[model samples]
Every structure is written in structure tokens, then in C-alpha cells.
Target: MKKFTQYVFCITILLSCKKIGTPELQPINLKISTVYASTELGKKLSLSKVLIKILNVNTNVEKQLITDANGNVSFQGISAGVYDISATITIPAATYSSVTGEIVDKDVIFNASDKNKTIGLTNNELNIKLVSGNIGNWLIKQIYYAGSNTTTGAGYRDQFIEIYNNTDSVMYADSLYFAEIIGRQSYTNTSYYTLPNGQMDWSKSLNMPSNIDANNNYVYPRALFMLPGKGKEHPVLPGASIVIAQTAINHKSPFTGTDGKTITVRDPSLTIDLSGADFEAYYAPFLPRPLTSDIDNPSIPNLNVLAYNGTDMLFDNPGRTAFIIFKRDGTEVKDYPKYNYPTISTPSSTSDKFYQIPNSVIIDAVEIQPNTASDRVPKKLGASLDAGYTFAPNGQYSSQSVIRKTDRTENGRKILKDTNNSTEDFDYFSLANPRGFK
Candidate 1:
């Protein structure tokens, strides 16, 4: 009886010494469903496979998977956390009628550590039109809109645009009018937007010609920076490019802004020396203080500013704007029609006036905006003018640029992609590639 009592006492002591701990963590299951299909032409309508990339925002852990025919893929086990999943798919041009599509969607999610979840992706349809109009022998090669590196944290003075002759024969840059568009970015801001409430009424904004339809003709820029030349003063040969700077004085050198403060270029390698630039946007001496960033280069002719709104000839450093380069026959000021912008609410105000230049004169056009999709609005340029839009990645003064992609070449002439879709035609580079081509 004494031995049994001793054994009970030992059991009680052992139970009292036991420790408590949490249960082990369980792995997560990830399932993705892609949206795809087939067409009447027996071609697969979408990408044969989908690319799924999941990034853990906290730990920076990455997981990738390719979806099969069923548009389905699953991860066996994943340690759950906050993740950003970006999915992309491309349809072959052969499948569609010369017009194919590409889709990309990035997401943010908080996944549970031990749960099976499915991410259903909505399939987007993009109809990329083959260029209806010939993109011409000349192309706008690179645009350094994001400014340059500076020690003072202000470096937009180096803003420059580059053009190229992609044709076999020589083309003239003479009499080319480069313009910066000014208007509302999206339809949501009715008070500020040109066409509020997404009105399809073209008569409200455009000044159409008698022979043209309002749908085709668009509202052109109010002010134009005209390149002064008679006929062939500026000739661009095949496989050649020209840089147009705000100041063609080796921007790599130090520059003084309106503040009269010296701004040192942090990385001269990041900027180019445009000392031999083809042209520069030179404003007149009469131009006031703030707009005086327009440095004068006597050797490089000034682009005549045709002002309609009485505003200075300048660019909005942080605004959603568009640009175009065009040359037309009889492009003298008289050839274009006069447009008076009547505020949607106040038609009699006569606050805005414009000189409408038709799309026929536009050689090339590019639409630029902020990088986010939700922040973007209806495109200002027509589908025929520019089917897609491109942007500056990191807001204003980020030192980024939108560079055009080379589509193909015929003979020896390089034909940059003129698909009019910025998504396909343009891409973002870490640093600006200016005058990379002579």
C-alpha cells in the first residue's frame, strides 16, 4: 500500500512539471483561375499559358507559376502573408485579325496562414489595331520627360524630346510644329474636364471642317511651338536622330534655375550634352520671370509660339498632358480654323480660344500620364492618332523616360512600332537613352 501511494505522488509531480505551447503553423493553398478561350479562325484566342507571379511585400519572397489549358494552377503549400500578385497574358497576332491583345493586373492581398484560397482573374480584351495610317518615315524616338539628376532636387530644366528619321530616304524636320496638349485628364472632374460626364458630343469641344466628321476631327492644341523653316532646311537622313532641348548648351553642365540658385548635376552620365542639338524651345526675351527657363540659343532657331489663350509657351511639369509633331501643307496660321471654348455651364464667357489643327497634319502623337490605371482618364488623342497611352513611372522629376520599341526594319531603315498602342510601343527605362543614335 505504501509503494502504490508513492507512485501516485510521482505522477502528480510529473503532471505539475508539464509545459504549455502553441500549435504548429499550417501551410496555405493558392489557386488561380485564368480566363481564356478560342476563336473562329482555329487560333487560340489568348496566351497558351498564363504567367502568375506572387511577391511577399514584407519579406520580398517570390513565387511564380504557369497556368495550364484549364486556366488553373495551384500552389501546394505557401507560408501566407501580404502578397502582390501580377498576372499577364498575351494573344498572338495571328489569332486575331492583325490586332492582338495583352493583359496585366497587379493585386494586393492578405492571405491566411492556413486556408485554401482562389484568385479569380478577370480576362481583359484589348483590340490592338494595326496602324490604319502610315506612321510615316519619321518617328519620335525618345522623350526624357522625367527630367535629370540634380543636387537641389529640382531638375526639370533638362526636359528634352528626340526625333528620328526611320525611312530609307531623307525627311525634313523643317516647318514641323511640336505642341504640348493642355486640358482635363479624366471625365470624373466635370468642373475641370473638357468633356464632362463622358459626353459623346463632339460638337461641344471640336471645331470640325465642313468635309470631315466631328468624330474624326479632334480639338488640337491652343498654342504651337513652330519650327521655322521654308522647305527643307532641316533634313534627317535614314537611321538618324535629332535632339531638341529646352537649352541645347550641354545640359550635363551646371544650370541656374529661376531661383538664381546653382543646381549641380549629380550624375552627368545620366544626362546628355545637347550642345549640338538640332533645335531648342527658345522663348522670347519679353517672356516673364517664371517662364524664363526658356534659355536662348541664337545658333538654334526658336520655335515660334502661337498663343491662343494668351498663356506662356511652356510645359506643365506635373500635369497629364499629350504631345504631337506634325507638318502640313499650307499650315500657315490662316489655314486653320478658329475655335472659341465655351464653358459647359457658361457658353458666353469666351474664356478659352483655340486654333484647330487637323489630325491630317499630325505626323506622330504620344499621350503621357501618371503610371496608375485608376488615376488615368479617357485618352485625349483619337484612336487613329494614338491607340494607347504611356506615362512617367514615378511622378514628376523622377528622371524616367518613355522610349519607343523597334518593331521591324525594311531594307536598312528602322521602323519603330507605330501600332499607336503605347502599352506595346513604349517602355520605361531606368535611365534616359538620349542621342544614343546620332
Candidate 2:
């Protein structure tokens, strides 16, 4: 009886041991989804494929499951209890068409699990816009001032003009001039100045600024003066002429008319009425002189003047001088000599010395009302400093912030989370680690 009872106890112990040795099973579920996509122009997107990874903590083993076409994916039958779970997606170099498509990369991280728990994600469709050109459709439009009514005196007034160049090609308009008319000559003697037609100016002589941009035009009010004995010093005189001439005409021409040695003004519009006393011309407001053309009648409003002092016709520096001294109307504000030479000097020269130069006389300072809103305009600080500079590709990465810390060893990281290209200055991580490139 004792032997039989012992045998039954041994069998019971063995059954208990077998039960204790059995392994416990835990289940876990994982799911992944794309949350956002890239849409701005010049961006590279890779949010198409998604994957979820299930890992065994004790055995250091992992399994992967791919998501659906819409970046929707799931993982089931994962061991529970703080398992090391990860997710991954590869962004293949997107197949693109010329009509419009995506160019995806071969590798990029799409998504990952958070806190080793079943995480839910909603993938957002990425709409990436591509560009064939930089600064597309943006042209070098006209130059302009803030507005009118900001003009001060000769140097204080704010005035600017527009030069529109819509094409990508570079452009240049040099030797331009601007001026008002003083008076017209009698039919016989063409020596006297004539009235201006349609945006016309004195074309016989011009003093163009040195540095002008080819692509972009500029506008600014400037004090102007003619070369020694070139044109009339009194603009706005009854029937006066304003012209814009090339620098080659700086020297006097010996062309004679019915009267005597009368100058011949050419016109591009082919409207030259040689018999008429006045003609047309085109001159920018800030230019120092004008070109000669045919002038039937000018419709541009003549600038009105309130006061003019003949003695002080230029600034103390003498680099700039008023060639014509008169009010807006036919009346002469101050009678300047028929001609006066202007002296040019550097900044080191004293104002008094510059005005007293030999052979080159300086005009006195004149007070004119403000013409435009340029006085209140601020100078662009950034444009002048870094006019031509760009960033290096390798160094550009330093400027960006990393949104996702990927595990390369796990082979479970999403491929969309990687960027191996240079980023545009304005690009940012607004979507699921997607970048823009054009």
C-alpha cells in the first residue's frame, strides 16, 4: 500500500513540473499610417510605402509586415509585454512622367512605433509640386519709388522710374538723359532750344551713371547739369526743348541749316519735321540730359516751381549743378549766365574749394519741393551686403533640425525619414520628414 501511494505522488510531481515548464504566450498588434505629405514647389516626397515591425525581446528576433498602397499597414501576433517593436518604409526613387509625377528616392523612413505599444497613425497624401525653372515666372519688373509727395530739394526729393524686363535675358539702357525745355528757335536759326514732345528730353548731350545692372532697371531723382556749353541753361522757357542724346554727340557738330550752323536732332520714331522749330524726345526723369527727336506737341505736365535763387543753383559740393534756372512756367526764377561749367570733385575736397575750381564753375544750391516718397524709403541692408553668394550642400544640413532619430541597424526604419540632398533655404519639415526639390 505505501509503494503504490509513493508512485502516485511521483506522478503528481512530474505533472506539476511539466505544467510549470510550459512557455507563456503574449499577443501584440501594431499599425502604421502616413500623417502628412509635401506639396510646395521644388520638394522631394516619399510617403508611399509603409511597414510595421514586431520584435521578440528575449530572443532578439524581429518580423516585418508591409502596409497597403495608401500607406496603411498592420502587424499581428506579436509577443506582448514591452516588446521592442519598430516600423519601416522604403521610399523608392519615384517613377515620374514629364506630364507630372513624383521622383521618389530608393530609401527613406516612413514611420515608427511609439513606446513599444500599438500606435495608430493616419497617413496624409503628399502632393509635391515640381518646377523646371528657378524663380519661375518672376520677372525683373519696373523700378519705382514709394509714391509722390516725398520730394525735398534738389538732393532731398525722392524720385524713381521703372524699367521692366520680363524676359530672362539681360538688358542695358545706357547713355540715357533727362531735361526740361527752355525755348524754341526761329525757323532760320536752330541754335535756340525747342519744345519737347511725348516724354522727350535733350538728346544732344547726356551724362549717364556709371554702374547700372543689366537685368534690373533703377530709378532715383538726381540733380542734373549739362557739359560745358552744350545746351540751353534755361529749361521751361517758352517753347523750350528737352532732349536725350548719345555721348558721341558731346562735341559740337558743324551741321548748318538755312540760318547758319544749326544742329540736327535725329529721331527713332521717324517723325522728324526738319522744317519745324521743335521736336520729340524720350528722357527718364532722373537722367541728366535729353535726346532730340521730332516734337509736334508734348503732353507731359511741366513741373511747377515755387522759388528759384540764381546765386545758389547747386549744392556746396559742386558735383551736381542746375543747368537751367527758371520757374515751372515761362518766367525765369533767376537769370543764370547763358552757360556755366560744372566742377567735379571727390569727397575729400572741401565744398568751398570745389565751388571755386578754375575753368569749371559750380552752381549754387536751389530749393525745390519734394517730388516723391523716396525720402521715407529705407535702404535695403541685406541686398547690398550679400549680393552674390550661395550655400554649400554639405554645410546646409547644419541649418536643419532632425525630426526623427532612425535606427539603421533595426532594418525597420521608414525610408521616407531620410534626406541626402541639399535643401532650399525656405524648405522645412512640415510633413512626415519629406523634402522639396525642384
Candidate 3:
């Protein structure tokens, strides 16, 4: 009886010891402060904010909280790690680029250690741009790079890009050229580029005598697609837009391709009825390419693939790409300096195929990236082009497209936001709703 009682007591103590040894993890405290970038102090940001959002990078978890009057926010006992914090603060209307009711938004990444980690969110208006005054009327409103999923579960032919005229007058889409940037962002990382590599590092002027527009224009393009039309042949009136498709046809209907094989779209709604699309991009030069799925519409004019530096111009599913629609003016291709490499990435590889486009002629430009921050590329567009880059949540082949935010409508014209910052100017949809018809 004594031995049995002792064994029971020992088992009870062992269970208690295990409970004491394996204590639950205690959370840590995180603090956040807000500020507005000061050009006076030169990059010094002042604090001001009412609310803030803290996001866990890995877990996709988010928390919203109000900041104290002093622009400080505290998260007690949060799992210590890295996080992205965003705060939108209303500043003096005259202080920032945003005119009326515009809020200065700032995002800062913080690493929260065991103790308290104070992260500062800075609203650097130095790079913030406004949609008014200088914003062009024509914009690349939407692009569906994530092709639809056909019945066979493969789809790329349904890709399309839509252009809109956000002005009160008609804008011609005629003779407009579309170029794909060859490099991620030329000025992103300059230390790695050297003259022996043929890559033009914006840091160093080639010194080779020429009137090249290589100063402010860093992102260069190798592929060029042009919209062939007379000056007024393709008139996109105010509040109007046009869809440029890979093939203008009802993707749902069964169709015969170059191989004389019937292709069917398993899900009708999943696909888009682009039969009425205004423009198409057909690899005219590479026509009859084996197993070429690209279909040409007899009614729609094709966007001549003027150039193709990459293997496929079908736009990458996740490749960070920057694009611009510019009218071919007197700017001679020879006038611009050349980045003599395939891309800034492959600096050692040689090629004289890239040319820089003067920013003035670019009607509108947009940069697409992956949903996550680390998957993003160095932003190529200046605050004048697009303040930031946007991405599809589902990434590739998800049929999601980045759509521009509507600022307002003036005199029957839809004035889309052109703050030159995609983060503030654009958002994503569950589906690619082209021309707002989703």
C-alpha cells in the first residue's frame, strides 16, 4: 500500500514538472510611429495618424489599431517577428501632392524582437505624384495577363489589354507604340554594372559622344508593338476605351486553330467574349510557328509585334514588367543611347537591341509585379509614370488583372486616378473585368 501511494505521488509530480517545463510562449510588444517626409529637413518625416494596420508577412495576419495622439501605436503581446505596417494620415492639404481630402499613406517594414521594437512609418512626399495638372488623358486602364483556364485547363489565348481615354475630348490610339522594358529597373542596383558588361549604369555616363536621352530615361525596351492607324482612324472618345486582344473572338465558343483542331472553352463565364475587341496582337512575323495557339480575328487589326526581345511577348505570368504607350514622334531611335545587353540582369550578355524612350512621349505606363513584396522588382516607373507597382493576388494564370482606380467623372468623362503611384492609384479584382464589364 505504501509503495502504491508513493508511485502515484511520483506520477503526479512528473506530470506537474512537464507542465512547468513546457510553458506557452509569451508574446512581445511592438510600437509604431507615423511621420510625413520633410523636404526641408530633407527626408525627415513628421508624425500624424489616427489608425494603422500591422500585417504579419508570413502568416498573412493583420491587426488594426488606433494610434495615440502622439502618433504612436502599441501592440501588446504579439508574436515577435517581422511585419509590414501601413498608416494613412491626413496631412495639410497644401503640404502633399494630393489636393483635397487626400491622405498620405506610408508603409514600413519592422522587425519585432523580444523586447519592444518601434517602427516609423514615413510619408515621403518627395516621390508622391498627383493625378491632376500634368496627367495624360490616355491610360492603360487594365491588362489581363493571367490568361483564362480552358476546358483542357490551359489558356493563354484570352489575354488582352485595355486602353482608356480619361479626357473630355477624343484621343487617338493611332500609331501608338507599346514597348516592354528590357531591364527590371536600370537604376535599381548600379554597383553591379560595369562598362565591360555593356550595361548602362545610370550612375556613369557612357562618355561616348552622342545626344542621347539617357539622363532621366533609365528603363529601356527591346520589344515594340504598334497600333497601326491613321491620326484619327482609331478615335477613342472621352469616357471611351478600346480592348486589345491576343485574338478577338468569343473564347467560350469552339474554334479551330491553325492545326485544324477544335478547341473548346470548358467554362463559358470563366472566359471572355472578346469577339468585339478593337485590336489584336498576332506574331505576324513568326506566323505558322508550330502549335501556335494565337488566333487572328478578321475584323480586328493586329498590333504588329514590332520587336520581341524575350522568347514570348505573351507577358510573364509573374515576371515584373513595365509598359508604356507612346506616340511615335520625331524622336529618332538612333537619338537615344543604347543599353548593349539583353537586360540589366544579364549584363555580361551582349546585344544592341535596347533603346530608351524619352518619358515625354509615353502616354501612360504601368508596372505589374507579384503580390508579395520580396517577389517585387525595383520600381522602374518614376513618380511621374506610376508611383508604385501593382500585382495580382493569385499571381499567374489566375485571370486577375490590375485595374485603375476611378478618381471621378467630369463632364461625362471618367477621370481615373493618375497619382503616378499604383499602390494608391490601383487595386485588383477577383476576376479580370475588362472595360469595367466584369
Candidate 4:
């Protein structure tokens, strides 16, 4: 009897050890739902066949599944951990136009993402609402904020941005405006005015109109420039792109700086030749002491600078900035009000002011943050404009760039992805490419 009791104790101990070795995993049941910007179209949209992806944040393991006719999907025996869930669906143009009475030449993509979600031992049903975004005809194709090597490459002088005509028809670039979005760059100062997300609370700025929803409805610009063209003067054909450079010159070869000095790169291959750039930013006239590299190319047109910042059109090399493109609307941008930072309770007469641009007029926007997650600031663009942000994975001075992904080619025309989520819609190029497709 004593031996039998000892044997039972040993079996119980082994069973306990086995349970500890393999903890019970939980199941995740997800429901996919469609949310239309137009409520009328919501009733007509279908929810089945949506692709859902769940990523284990800790393990980087991803699982993909499709929703059934009832918009239901399940993942059994998933380890409890932090996860990121995303869903995407494409609706045919004909179907979308027929349901909404809107005409679109290409399919519309709807995307949704829930980040840093925790799934514990308790299983629960989560509903993901897919949102359709504004289909933009002219989109920001690529951004080269990560300039070349400081010692061996062109440095910030090689930075450029490309804009593409995403539609099949010709779109004139007349009076189209683009700007470098400005916001609070730090997160440590709690005494300053900030939004719930820790972004600058522009509504708190002195002399800011109280009637308007400044925080959500508008964005401030550090620099604003307009593409030079009369109506139909600058026709961008379908699948074509225009490159805008800081200095329109061949960076691969030695060039004469504005200071009458020679500037050369140790490695020409690390930089690109922008002599053929369609437009360049000339800031010498605006700055008291302009950067020597801010040379102008007479052949290439200069963007009309409405608002200037820094000594030149230099992007933040550390990738702490956002950009947006819009067109002239009923209200003139020059007439828009400017205000000082909200942190200043009393502003002097000569305080620097930032131009407030209405979100309704913005055509496209992309938010960029530091490659290191800990240094990231609050999102400047809202979810409606850009649900996610992207950056050059290699960081500053790496000659890398964030380029939009190609969704598919229809009739040999490249249709770049524009799901209002840069993280999902963009990919990085090891080197910056002007007028190049990914």
C-alpha cells in the first residue's frame, strides 16, 4: 500500500510538470464588418471574402485567413500574446460606382488595422471595421527623406519627392500645392499644450479661431509650395510621375555650389542625378544666409514658395516629418490664418507663425517617423488621412526611400496602392528612384 501511494504521487508530479511545459492556448474569433464613408453605400457593400491577417507582435509570426459569407473567421489554439490585426478588401470599380453613384476607373481598396491588441487566455470575439478611403488621382509616389551618407554621399542636398498620376486620364498639375506638415516634435514636455495623442493642440494657440475644429479639421504647414503651371500647361499622363528636387543638378558628378565653390560626393553611386528634375525648390532669395547647395537650375521650373522654413528646402534627415499635397480650393491659402505655438501664452509681434491648411482640401498625405520606435512622436495625420506611418528602415543618411507599392497594372498602366495606410501601401527602396516604379 505504501509503494502504491508513492507511485500515485510520482504520476501527479509528472502531470503537473506537463501542464506547466505547455500552457493552454486560446482561440480568437473575429468578425469582419464594412464601414462606408457614405452610409447609403454601407447597405449595398458585401463583407465576405475579406482577407484578414493577424500578426503576433512578440514572435513576428503572422496568420492569414478569409472571412466566410457570414463575415466570420476563427483561429484556434493561438498563443496568448500581443497582436496586430488588419483586414483588406477590394471592390470592383463597377460595383462601387453602381452602389454609390460615383465614377471610378480603378478598383477601390478598403483597409483596417488594430495595433497592439492583447489576447489573453480569455477568448473573445473582436469585430474589425473596414473603412474605404478617398481615392486620390494624384498621389505622392516616393519620399527620399533619408538622404545619402553625410561623409561619402550627397547628404540632404539629394533629397527629392515624386508625385504620380494614378488615374488613366491626364491630370493637369496647375495650382497644386504640397506642404511639409508641422507638429510637436517632442513627447517629454507635459507642460505644453497637446492633444490626447500628445500631438500639438493647435486649438489652444493664441488667436486661433474657436469656432473651427482646429485640432481635427486642419493641419499646420512648416513650408508650403505650389507647382508652377497654368491650366493644362503641365499635363501628367497616366502612369507618369514628376520629380521635385531640392537642387536640380547632377549629384553624381561634381557641381558648383551657389557659394562659387565646388561640391563633390565621395561615392556618386550613393546619390542620384536630378538635373532632369521637373521642378526644384529655390530658397536663396528667402533666406538671409542660404545654404550653399541651394543652387537653382534655370531650365527647370521653381516651385512657388508660399511658406519657407529653415535655410533651404531641407527635410529632417532623422525622418521626423510628414508631407501632404492639395489643390487650390475656393479659399485662398494666402488668406488663411497663421498662429504661433500653443505653448506660448503671450506671443510677441514678430513670433514665427505656421499656416493652417484645411484637411478637406488635402489630396494625399504621408507621415514619417524615426526608424527607432521609442523616438516616434505623436501621429500628425489622422487615421482618415493616413491610418499608419512609414519610414526608411535604414534610418537617416542611408540613401533609402519609402515608395508606394504597385497594386496591379491595368492595360499597362501602373496603379499604385493608396489605402490611406502608408505602412501597408509603401515599401522602401535601397536607393532613391526618380520616376521609377516599385
Q: Among these predicted structures, which one has the highest TM-score?
A: 4
Off by over 4 Å in 2: 1-7, 13-23, 26-48, 70-82, 90-109, 115-438
| Error of model 3, residue 131, in angstroms | 12
Q: Candidate 3 clashing pairs? A: 35-46, 36-45, 36-46, 151-266, 386-420, 387-420, 387-421
Work out the TM-score per prediction.
0.64, 0.21, 0.67, 0.82
Between candidates 1 and 2, the one scoring higher on TM-score is: 1
Candidate 1 positional error at 152, Å: 3.4
- Runs of candidate 4 exceeding 4 Å displacement: 1-87, 97-106, 113-130, 344-349
Higher-lDDT candidate of 1 and 2: 1
lDDT of 2 by residue, 155-211 (tens): 101112111222223322221122211111122333322222111112221232234
- Tens-place lDDT per residue, model 1, 1-438, is 999999999998776655321111346566765443224322434433655656554554678887677556676566655444444444333434343333312111111111111222221111111123335556777877777555543376667788888777887787777777655555565653244324233455434345655434654575577777887988888878877777776766776655667655666766667678788775545555435444566797666667622323434445367788877766575577755543355444555666666777778878776665445545566545665467767756676778888767678666776555454578766666675531
TM-score of 3: 0.67
Error of 4 at 219 (Å): 2.0
Over 338-414, each residue of candidate 3 has an lDDT whose tens digit, in order, gives 55543235444343556767787787788776676556555455545654467788877777778888887777567
Per-candidate RMSD vs. true structure? 11.8, 31.5, 8.4, 5.6
lDDT of 4: 0.84
Q: Count the backbone clashes (under 3 Å) in each candidate.
A: 0, 72, 7, 0
State the lDDT of candidate 4 residue by residue for 1-438, as single tens digits.
999999999999999988886654435454434354445666778778888888776676988888777566787667777676777778999998998788888788777766556676563457666666677989999999999998999999999999999998999887899999988787886645897667888888988888999987889989899998878888899999999899999999998887799999999999998999989999988788888888889999999999987887888878878999998678888998898888746767888899989888889999898887556677787656776778999999999999999999999999998988888889999999898888
lDDT of 3: 0.61
